[model samples]
Target chain A: MKHYREPSIEAAETGKPSRKGLVFLAGLTLLFSSCRLDMHDQPKYESYEASEFFADGQASRIPPEGTIPQGGLRQGELLYTGKMDGGDSELFPFPITQDTLVRGQDRYNIYCSPCHDKVGTGRGIIVRRGMKQPPSFHIARLREAPPGYFFDVMTNGFGAMFSYSSRVQPRDRWAIAAYIRALQLSQNASYGDVSEEDLEKLEEAATE
Target chain B: MAQLFHPNINILIRILVGVVVVLAAGLGLAYYQGYYSVYFSQVNVFREQPVMFSHKHHVNGLGIDCRYCHTSVEVSSSAGIPPTHTCMGCHSQVWTEAPILEPVRESYRTGTPLQWVRVHDLPDFVYFNHSIHVKKGVGCTTCHGQVDQMPLMMQVNTLFMGWCLECHRNPEDYVRPREEVFSVSWVPPSNQKELGRRLVEEYQIKSRTNCSSCHR
Candidate 1:
């Protein structure tokens, strides 16, 4: 056949590849470029993204009034509000079990330890870092303050401290109050505060 | 024609061309590789903050917990920065006259915030929840690296999509006990892979690879 010949000298000088290489490269490029990016800029409304469907033109719909949210029902005054007859109450809504105390400790370390400190000394790491040092729980005034008073401060903002109702639930707030009471008791404890059996253990440890 | 006949000269030309090609290829590969390497990708780039607060000093030296300064870590998406009062609580007593603390004092006096530059910044599109991660048994060190060791905060991980996917697809490899979430020096136990799997089941963590999980 007339055209069945080796590549010409001109082809070598031009540096043209054989037909197979060009076709292969074209196929590879097409394969890569064909991937659909439809998922990236999706037709979706983000949280609070404005919408035309709602009359307010806001995507986030406000819950209807009198709507008791799931797990949002606050039936008891002492449990939720920390108040009875518009004043702080002394009694706990739930029994203060050892498990409750442990939960209180965990919650306290996470939330209150920054400001009130591990010992409720008002000299937490944040206080050392530079925030206003609150009154120590060991102070006679705070030591005598009822548990509900602390709960009031947490539920409703007290002075410079903001309300922790958002971060802490009502039950957890009571737990924190209980823990704070324990802390106050710890720092202000006298020999009379210890039981006879615990006193013996303490004496033994001291003698050792 | 005479120049072409010189065999040594021809050999020298070939060797020079070969060296150029090898050098070019080496440089190109290095440019590609180094661009993505953890060492070079802003890994140790320390941004200057308004206050020269050192995590090394506050965390390691003073034994401060990560939550002390980043207060809202357990409740909010962003770990809240400590307010100006938090700084003055100590400076009001200790470093009252130190010139290094001038800006902090000024912010306190003005009732204005010291605008601390964020170091570990994520893109606007990505939705990362600190509370979910922290509550799900991911420790502070798991994502933030050894921040107590960092004198000035710097981005350590690349925080690229692949890096995120690597963990998201296999959370059992990294999950720890909830109690150890705050422990900066916490090491995975000898039976970690086994424990982690149990934790994955207990925590009910479905390591989702769907785009909407993080993107939305």
Candidate 2:
């Protein structure tokens, strides 16, 4: 019978490895490439204890009610009456400039048109689908209302409407009100029409 | 007789093994530290401010309210940073000499706002309402930490999504009286569960367990 001789170290090291080395390599590959074992997996709590709501140490220092410290109108005027007596003095207070009307129209289409309709007719999809119906802008009371009044209704919200104060800023709400006024006027123009010269100018502009 | 191994081949193997080990270690360190910057590169980490603005000084010391500076917090999506004019209201006379007050004065003169770094930041996707939380008796300190004590405020709690979910899931377990909104002092409830039950019954507080309450 022929005797088998052990391979020399030089022969063993010549190529990759023996069968045992290949098995070890495969095992290491599996071990290192395994799914991650995360240690900080425990869920973090918001740390809001019930005691936080109670008058505890520094937590008890509650701010006063309705304390808007910045450039807003006082609550009674800005929120209720829509007057900007104490609002930012530098900015134009809600009578609606020519540019504001254009901006207001754009904003109205984006926000109010979905619920109030483009024509201010109150027949929006939400209304048509049997949700709460908004009052038409064509009504005499709303048509005659000041721009500030409309702004107030938009901010603090009127009956059956939740406050848009969260969604719309003070200035944007005023802009929408301005646009609503424009819509009201357009639909209700009366016998006191444009002068002949003005009409001619408008006609000439249209031709151009 | 021994066969000679190439010196370059041995060096190449050693270099390859070293590179693999280093790459593995780096990946492991990043995973361990919760370094998810790669995934959320767009997320702006809430930053700490340079100067210490004291809520305690204004709100507690001078009897000013949170609304004075954060006027829009209750009514708008953002708490709204106070313009320089708001700070000039009192600082105009109060702390004219303080070195830290110089930045504030400059901002007012230039009609610029102080770049007060925000500390409490929720994820962009989550919708949190300050007015609803304030009105519902959730205290500012519940999320803001001890702002009165913080010299230069840092985020005390991890404002993670799970953190918000926990309180929102169990509001009564966390809700307290509206008046105690700012106090850090804890006075144990005589009846904990009873208070929770009462709030649930009286306030008609629909379960915050609903996903849409905070998620939407």
Candidate 3:
């Protein structure tokens, strides 16, 4: 009120009305402006929104059959199905690298570790919560199983576990199979399996 | 006419004017606060979804990964919402008889999608890509909060322009190791300043405050 000098103190003396009420009214109007949300939410569909116009009631749609998205041509029978010449191939379709193993480890932790456990043991958090326990990767049968067998099981699913093909990509699936090999070695290996250089480091650590 | 009024009334009028001014100022403050409150912004307010999926039970209790259901978070713009089949993946085997999961089972059987109410819906004009944020080492919990702790999904950040600008302007304050992006209980270490700065540099995150960066 002090900031606004009377629009006319002389007018006040002459009995003219003040404009101060208009300023207060404008402030009130501005306050209500925040409530308007015409732009906050628009007429367009957001992801996974139910569509009234669509017959399926979904804003997203399933692609027609035989439609292949980019990089989705299911070529390389060994890579896609873990089989070649009508049998589960015992070799990886692509050469495995350190980066592939790292990526596999990451994906495995996210998609498989829930049921297979971080150590690839039968006990995971889900098993404790009542889901069926998966077989350990350390078992004799699984240890003797080819890398292709592991990839096949993940793509098609085993007895109790669901197929992860839709969740994990093909490259990552191969990568997880590779990581499972490394994990098996980690669990079943002895001191003799270590390299001389690494064994020396292990001995140093053991002494410490 | 009797001096138009009692001279003492002038003091009374002045006091009333002061009261009116103070009252108006208080009202303005309340209006501003109210505009940003949970009622208006929906921050920290949980909306009831159809099935009432609990992230706490799935994430913390069962150790399910965020990517277990939202599989495309790293590869696509929008984080994929799991179809009912994803829910049935486990529920069909474990919680097969639970009344709480009847809607999920029904959706799976009937092939009708469950209407899940979106929790972190941004304005239509703003373009947000989950993949870019994930690739740039912005942890899921950075914007979404610690979802493992939420029994019901809710908005944690205000999702306002000012709130986004905080990270966009200085990503070093929020960036984490790419490996830790999906981790539920990952806390910023004491050396977050150093680590985040390195990650921001390593991830090549640009300080994108241009209107075109978000608004198309």
Candidate 4:
């Protein structure tokens, strides 16, 4: 206490603070500022950064064997695997209504249209840009291919095509497959496929 | 000391010292005020990247959707960065021999990923889910600003916790129709508050103010 008060008392009496004391205080402040070792630089693991703690040296740990996360118990065959017990299912897992078709169309336009093209002609912008052109949906082979086949392709991926499992959900995959079927029908359908009223409308449209 | 300073000189010296102190205080106040400003925060600062990719060229000129490159934004936590194949898809045909595209070509040739520098990086602790925000009908322009207009992608928002809470406090002001989620030029329609209220209920959007919502 005496040492602390001595300097200020001396300064007041002398009308000037000692330069030595000022220099010492400034040096102490500089040292304290420079010696910042805080929680910011504390030992912590960042995502995907190397870790010495883990034996494998990876910060990310693999999930335990047979561990299924919440809502991840994908039990049903058609729902999860896009196939029946034996092979690709002939029927859709759920009913495909007009709304479902619309959803499918929207999702397809967003995800599939990049490579499959709007009309499924296999000449999408990416294909034109130099990526390998996928087989057109209008092709007889693909037209005859079951809906499950398309689902499997989207789920498992085929050739250069990457699996869209993460991007497109299971139901949306079916929708996309339905849209592909619709595209196939649009290209391959004959005049007989049109209803009489629609035929007349088409004829009138052609005439006009 | 043989009269080192005259009385007037000493007075002038004291006045100058006072002025310096006042000026320093004024400067400190200005710095504090500008701490979160565009200049200090680097809000519109164009960050340089390995490749001089132009968002304006791809988004505005070519009319490419945001999802074209940032795929899985609707489903994944991250807006997925385009793989080398995606770049090669166009550059292979258009900029086949341009030296500017040499890095892209090299990536394609070697199958090594391009190291794109991230611009709008949040703190490590902040848990952000792109899908949840997109699904909740928040438009891309809400947080990202007019990215389509920028030639170089610059972080427009301050992205501070307070900035995030401003929206989370009342999401209706920012929420849009599902179709308008990706529309960069979308503005609130006339009945925005009403529509937003309806949507908040319909979508079950309870903007969680709990710190753990983002912190964990």
Candidate 5:
């Protein structure tokens, strides 16, 4: 049987184990340790990853036309279109609860506050920058505008404002309209509009 | 073996062994640190993009909401990149002929999508969702760093598994109020530990340290 150190010259000559083979093996281990990315970056494409396969460097291709995504088939005429019988409906498709109003406020701040301002006065940062100034919700014309009119304006573009159909969902558009009604009420409120309990507090403050 | 070791060889051998041990330890430390350094981890590195979009200008200067451009961030896995139309929405009226905005104009004109280079690319095997993180009270700035301060977007953390495990094991260290999630300059209050603890319980943040929590 051949000895364990059969391959080394020094082992063959002197019978003493040589360190050369061990050193070479250690070097090989070190060389190979730093180089395996086989599982790190796979061949699959993420949402907006670049692709060499297509002429347009995009891995995410637009679905072929007539291909509706799940939930794309919109139901409810008033809900999706904000219209009923070929005209904007005055009533909300869903009831406007306090929660819906709060959701509307949150969405409004994110989407509309840039141009409409927090108080719905139309003098927002975007307007101050250069864009055309939108009419205030407190104006008499807008004050009397039905909820569906605001919904239609948001669903389709109004004068200088672009349609927010892409940025905001249909339900959110109605919620925003509800909030606009809330805003118009807040802005145009008079002494007669105040409740008896709230009026007592206002009366106390007014007297002070 | 006449004098295999001189009488003083004992001290020489001890000193030589000490030196070897110190050298080995030094090499080991260098290897460990080099392996995890930002250079290797892809941290704080800036990559060139087709358009030099600045978060500072859009976020801090203009005070535009993060949702304005990243519309699907709250609902989708991806914080949606603004299409050319979204850009043209403002630029059409704001800076009609600025040289810097020429690429935006061209893309809008030609209907070609502008290719944006991704900054926070995780390893393909790890699954991350923007909606889940944002919903669970992880502020955008928590993982994204002070994005409002970045002129050109750059990766802030190492994005290593070990770093992720630190948060996964204890979420109270980073959780915040849900309402303040999109706030660009949110400073953790002095009582963050207590506030964060309450938020973790309220938000139902599971200390998801299992391999599949992110690996899947």
Candidate 6:
């Protein structure tokens, strides 16, 4: 049988020290495992106040007062009363001009063509797909409507139509109304007095 | 003694793991609860006007148009609120004894415009035009509910993006002619779809359904 011997003092001391070291290491590992760095999370930029954004103060140019031309009818007032007050002629002046018609056409394409169609036939895609269909500018009643009436409708909103008062400026709306009148005339133009030169140009265009 | 020593080491390790788990769980519970409680929620807390001055009353009731009070609504970007003197135009001679008129009187005397609370307010990001709506024959009631009936006006409708879109999607269904625009008695035609179609054809009306029409 092997002789029984007491454990070495050095070994016993080192054994205890090693055990404590192991325990400390375990504790440290647990602590470290619990902490995490969130590298993916980032800070976002915040929106600034209006004053800060427009620091130059140039953004606050208040428009001059009394800019709207006078003699225009106000809201709730009738457009035109069929009276021969000489004002009636001024209200719906005859002989629509080429430049006026062109301006009107430009305005119509921008504001009206999207829904009313370029020809003012109300066949715009918005209408074709069962959307709200606007009346043709070529219609008799609308064709006869006074400029003031168009101006009023554009200023206020008619049925289903909300007001453009906030969308189109007053002067621009007036321009658009003038354009609508021009559209009506173009659709209703008579071929009775066509010049030979005009007719020849039309024929040449058609042939092309 | 040897058995006891190894078990003690194991027990220490177990306790260390348990403490870390508990700490993590506690932190997670706190974080989730705070997140669900709307940690970043903020309320708009600005003071606004109090009385609901009727654009309808001044426009329709007395036949005073929008320009009469909001003098620059047409020409300018802002359809400005009328000054105290605008109220004193008629109130000084008309309803001098009324209780509500007291504020109007005080504002005039003090040279301060009555801080009449604005009700139909939109977000600053939105670009709304009073002139365009007015020009289009859009009744004031479309956005601002029936003001003639209200003494002190409350916001009648939610001026939300969705609410505006609802009308925009089908404008002619709600549109009335120029003559009936201001009249409270005005009613949408029975055949709204047909009427819309007719208006689009006859009046050369434009569609407001597009995003750029209102948003841009």
Top candidate (lDDT): 3
Off by over 4 Å in 6: A1-208, B1-67, B71-78, B97-99
Estimate the overall C-alpha local distance difference test score of candidate 4.
Answer: 0.81
- TM-score for all models, in order of appearance: 0.64, 0.43, 0.86, 0.69, 0.86, 0.40
Residue B76 local lDDT, model 1: 78
How many residue pairs clash per model? Answer: 8, 16, 0, 0, 0, 52
DockQ, candidate 2, comes to 0.02
Query: What residue pairs clash in candidate 1, if any at all?
Result: A130-B85, A130-B86, A130-B87, A130-B88, A130-B89, A130-B90, A131-B85, A131-B86
lDDT of 6 at B153: 53
Q: What is the Å distance of residue A69 in model 5 from its true position?
A: 1.2
What does fnat come to for each candidate? Answer: 0.06, 0.00, 0.83, 0.17, 0.71, 0.00
Every candidate's chain B TM-score: 0.83, 0.71, 0.91, 0.84, 0.87, 0.65
Task: Point out where model 2 deviates above 4 Å.
Answer: A1-208, B1-50, B59-63, B184-190
Question: If you assessed candidate 1 against the hidden native complex, which CAPRI class would it receive?
Answer: incorrect
Judged by DockQ cut-offs, is candidate 5 incorrect, acceptable, medium or high?
A: medium
DockQ of each: 0.11, 0.02, 0.57, 0.21, 0.60, 0.02
* A75-136 per-residue lDDT for model 6 (tens digits): 42223231234322225333446665675665566455645788878776545534466677
Instruction: Name the regions of candidate 5 deviating beyond 4 angstroms.
Output: A1-34, A196-208, B1-24
Residue A33 lDDT (model 6): 46
RMSD of 1: 9.1
What tens digits encode model 3's per-residue C-alpha lDDT throughout A71-175? 678877898999877887799999999999999999999888887899999788878778888889999999999998989998998887778889988889999
- Model 2, A1-208: lDDT tens per residue? 7498777686478865677778898877756543443322223222121233445412224479876658654544453446666542222354668887887786676457655888998876545544367889999888767677777677766665655665566667777887897899877876367678888887899999
CAPRI quality band, candidate 3: medium
Candidate 1 regions with alpha-carbon error over 4 angstroms: A1-88, A91-100, A111-141, A152-172, A184-208, B1-24, B37-40, B89-94
Better of 1 and 3 by DockQ: 3
Q: How far in Å is the alpha carbon of B20 misplaced in model 2?
A: 13
For candidate 3, the chain B TM-score comes to 0.91
Better of 3 and 4 by DockQ: 3
